[model samples]
Target: MRIIVYGTLRRKQGNSHWMTNGQWLGDHLIDGYELFSLGHYPGVVEGTGQVYCEVYRIDASTLGELDALRSKGGEYKRQLLQTPYGSAWLYVYQRSVAGRQRIESGDWLKRDAVSE
Candidate 1:
């Protein structure tokens, strides 16, 4: 299965282990979506315009390992998303925050940039 990854997973020296072993399918943009940081990883949400990120094709067996690393049962959940490249699953935060402003896709900031 293919997965769209953003944030730390996008960086070469970070949590990008999946990319080294998995098939790199190049980068693509997901329209009507935006990226947000949820502590350790990033969450992609439905928004306006296009959200850009890299994608990887991994074996289905690896899903279990990925789920554990992402704490799938807790804060994050995998959801199906349609991007310009194709369809894939992405991990996103499940908890809701009232009045939390959804940033535009073009203005979606990266965690590393914020720290810098």
Candidate 2:
């Protein structure tokens, strides 16, 4: 299945830190989606912006592993969203602050770009 990943996973060499690592297929621009900081991790939501994302083509067998890494029913939830790339599932923060704006398309905030 094709999955769209945003947040920390999108950062250079960041997603590799996880044991259940996914292959980086390529980068994509998700229209009507926005990026927001959810706790220490990053997530995306439905909005009017172009959210930069990393696309991953993974086997269905890895779903369990991915779910575990994402803390199933915890910090994040697996959601199905329709993006320009295609229909896919993503992990997003369950709780979010109201009125938060997401990153524009092709405008990913790299680790070095984030102010401490």
| Candidate 2 whole-model C-alpha lDDT, 0 to 1 | 0.63
Per-residue lDDT, model 1, residue 59, is: 80
TM-score of each: 0.72, 0.67
lDDT (tens digit, per residue) of candidate 1 on 2-65: 8877666674737777566778788877676666655555566665656667788878776667
lDDT against the true structure, per candidate, is 0.65, 0.63
The runs of at least 3 residues in candidate 2 whose Cα sits more than 4 Å from the true structure, single-residue gaps closed, are 17-21, 82-86, 99-108, 111-116
Give me the displacement of residue 91 in model 2, in angstroms: 2.1
Clashing residue pairs in candidate 1 (N, C-alpha, C atoms within 3 angstroms): none
Going through the candidates in the order shown, the clash numbers are 0, 2
Residues 1-116 of candidate 2 have per-residue lDDT tens digits of 76777765554546544424556677777676666754466666666777677777667767667778886658677887665556777776666647644443335455236444
TM-score of 2: 0.67
Candidate 1 structure, TM-score to reference: 0.72
When superposed on Cα atoms, how far off is each prediction in RMSD? 3.7, 4.0
